[model samples]
Target: MLEDAGGHVRDADDDQMRLECGVFGAWNVAESSAITALGLHALQHRGQEACGIASFDGQLFHTERHMGHVGEAFSGTDLVHRLPGRYAIGHTRYATSGASVIRNVQPMFADLEASGIAIAHNGNLTNFRALHTQLVAEGSIFQSTSDSEVILHLVARSRKGSMEARFIDALSRIEGGYALLALTNECLIGARDPLGIRPLVLGELDDAYVLASETCALEMIGARFVRDIEHGEVVVISGKRTLRSSRPFPAARARPCLFEYVYFSRPDSVVNGRSVYDVRKRMGACLAQETGVDADVVVPVPDSGVPAALGFAQASGIPYELGIIRSHYMGRTFIQPTQGVRELGVRMKHSPNRQVLEGKRVVLIDDSIVRGTTSRKIVRMVREAGAREIHFRSASPPIKWPDFYGIDMPDRDKLLAARKTLAEMQEILEVDSLGFLSVDGLYHAMDAGPRDPVHPQFTDHYFTGEYPTRLLDREIAEGRNDPVERQLSLLVTA
Candidate 1:
C-alpha cells in the first residue's frame, strides 16, 4: 500500500519527487466558511490523495470528505452552502499506511454513544503493528489499515470524563510522529507528538485560531502567522479559551522528520521560521562548494531542484540554463491515490524537452534519488533528445533508507540506492557519471540559520546505519525527529 501512493509529477519544470501529506485545522471563532476552503487550496501541494473538512455550528457537526483536490470535491453553492458554522477544521491527505479508497478518506469521524469526534492526521507511527495487535486483542474492530485510524480508535476506547484527557491518553499510547487535529462539540484540539516528527503551526485570523502543517496555509487564508506549535505541544483552542500542555507526557520526546523541508513542504513555506527554499538552495550551494566536476551546462531535474540549481550555478560559477523543459499538462499522481489511477497518472503528467538536450553534456541537479525508476526514465528521455552525456547530481545524499514519516515508498527490495552503489546506479540509470552530496555537506548547508538544529530531521539510517533522534529510530534497518542533538559535529562514520 505504501509503495503505490504519493508520486508528485513527472517533470513539469525535469524533476520527479514525492511530496509528503499536508495538514490544516481551523477553529473559526470568526465564523469563516470560505476560509477553510482557501486553507485547503494553500495546502494543495501537501496532499492530493484526498481532501476533507468538518465544521461545528455549536449544536451540530458537518463534514465533507472525498477523494480528490479540495476544489474538485467541494464545488459550487451546493457543497459550500451545506456547511455553515462558526468553527471549521480541514484536511488534505496523501495516503501513507491506508489504501487509496474513498472509504479511507479523512477528517475521519465517528459517533460514539456519548460524543462524536472528527480527526485529521499528518504523520505515521512506527509501532503501528504492535498497537493494532493490542487493539484487536481487545476486540476493537478496525475500519481501515491506516495507522492514523488507530489514533481515533484509541481515543474512542478510552473516553474518560474530558476529551482532553482521552486525547492525551491516546497520544501516550502511540509511538511515532504525528501532527493531529481533532474537532468536537465544545472545542478544537491540535496535538504534535513529543518528538515533533511533523509540523503543526499556529495562526490567527481575527479571533480565529488556525492550526496547519505549514505557514503557506496561513497566508492563503490571510491568517497572521503566530508561531510553531512547539515540539510535543498539545494546544486546545475554543471560542472562549486557549490552553496548552508541554512535552514529556510520561513519555520521551524525540525529533521531527527532516524531509518536511527537503521534499515534503512547498518551497514557499517557512517551517519553524526557516525558509524551506532557502534551506534547499543552501544545500545545493554547499554541495557545489564541495563537489561538481568540470561540467558543460548545469540543469535541474525541475521544480524541486530549481532553487538549488540556481544556487549551484551561483556557487560553481557555471551558467544555469533551462536545459530541460517539463510538460505541465501532466497531472499529479498523488491526485489519483489508487494504484490503478496512478498507473495512468504518470502518463498524463511529464514530458521532456528536446530543444536544449539536442547536443549537450549536462549536470542534472535533483533533491534526492530514491528508487531510480523515474531517474532512469529521465536519463533515457534526455538521451533520446540527443544529449552528449548526462551527469546526474543529487543535492542530498542517496536515500538508502525508507521513511517512516508520512512518505510512502517502495519496500527495501525495490529501493535502488539501498541495494546499489553509485556506479551501479549510474549503470542502471544509463548516465555518464552520478554524484550525491555527502551527508555532512547537507548538514553544513542547513546549519547556518538561527533555528533550533535539534528540532527534527529525516532518519539518517541510510547513510550512517544509525538515527539522529531516538524517537522514530528502531531495528527496522531503515527508517525516518525533533529536538537538537548537541553532538552533530561528530560525523557518522558510514
Candidate 2:
C-alpha cells in the first residue's frame, strides 16, 4: 500500500490507526539479495518509511537502500538482476520517534571490518543516543540518526574473533525493544531485545531457513512456519549450523509492549505464539466488560479496531453499525508534502455516517489514543454527524510514555493521558464518556487459554517506569539502567 512519490498508503474506508512497520530476512540461501526483497515485500505492512536489502555472497556484500516505497526503490528488473548472491536481510521502516529523512534508512552496513555487520532493525531503542554518544567519545563516527547504527559500532569493537560472542556481549549493552536481523559474511543473526516488544519468527523454505517479523510474510514467500524467536533468544544462522544461546542471565521480568495487540501488528500475524486477531478481540471484549452500555449502535474505528469493535458489540449485544466510512483510495496522510495537509487529510480520509449517528447513543471503540489529536478529530467528525451521545472506549490502557524502541511517535507532552486525566481528555475530545481497558485486560488478551506463558524478556516501561538491566555497580546504595538514557540526556545540551 505504498504511495508513489511519498511513502504512504491511501486510507480507504476506515478510521483506525495504521500499524507502523514491516520487516523480513533470509539467510543460508542460494539467492540472497533477491529473495530478501521478496521477504521485505511480504512484510510491506510493518513500515513504509524506506526500504532496503543487504546481501552477502561469501566474498562480497551488496546493498540497496531507497528513500521511497520498496517497489519504486528497487523496481528496475536490471537492478534486481544485478543484486547478486544468497544470504540476505531486508527492512521497511516507519520512523518510530525520529523524523523521516534519508538519514534514517536501514540495513546500514560496515564492510571495513573483515566479514562486516549489516543490520536491519524493527522497534525503538530507549537508549540509542546514549550508546551512540559513548561510541563517538571513544572515536566512533556515525552516518545516520538511526539507533541501528549503534549496534554496528558495538559489533565492530566486539571481541575480535567470534561473531556470536561479540553480538551477545553487545546485546547486553542495549536496552529497549528490538527484533534485529543482522548479516555478516559468515552468519545471519536474529536477535530480539530482552522484552520482545517487536515480533520476529522463524520459518523454513526448501534448503533455506527464514526469519521474518510475521507469519504472513513467511507464508507469502512460501516458507513453512516454525516457531517465533522467543524473548531474549538470539538465533545465529551460520553456513553449516544454526546456533542459539539463551542461557546467560539473571531472571528478567517479561512485560511485552501491549501496543502490538492493540494496534501495531498486522491482524493476520502471530506474535509470541498467539494470534494477534484473537488477542485484540479479547481486548474489545474486555472493553465491553468495563463499559457495558445501552447504545443504539457500536462503531469501531476502521481496520485495526474492527476486531475489538466486533467483540464489544457481541459482548454488549448492541448491534454493530458502520458509522465511519473510510476512503480506501486515499493515500497515506503523513507522507503528504505539508503537515497542515496531513492534518486536513485525516478528516477527508474518514467520514462519519450521519444516518447511524443521528439520534443515537453510539459506542466508539478505538485501539489506543496516542496524543489525542486523531481521537479528537474523530470525535469532532462524529459530533458533526449529529450523534446524541458518544461513549469512547480504548481497547488498551492509556499510552502515557514514549516508545524508545524505534516506534516513530511523540514525546511525553504529546500524549493526552500523560498530561491530563481521562476526564480531561473526554472534555477535550468533546465525548460523552471515556473508559479505558485495565492492565489485566491487556495481559489476558495475549496470554490465551489455560496456560499463560509469559515472555521471559518483556518490558512494560511505557506503562510503568520499569526497564531492563545495566552495566552493574556492586554498591547497593543505588541503581538504574546502564545509563543509556542518561548519556543521551547530554545531547539535549547540543
Report, for every candidate in turn, its global Cα lDDT versus the true structure. 0.72, 0.72
RMSD per candidate (Å) reads 7.1, 6.2
**Cα error, candidate 2, residue 254 (Å):** 3.4
Q: After superposing candidate 1, which stretches have Cα over 4 Å from the reference?
A: 1-20, 29-33, 96-98, 241-245, 248-254, 332-348, 448-459, 468-494
TM-score of decoy 1: 0.85
lDDT of 1 by residue, 384-411 (tens): 8788988888888877665555666554
lDDT for 469 (candidate 2): 38
Per-residue lDDT of model 2, residues 3-24, tens digit only: 2111224332122333345667
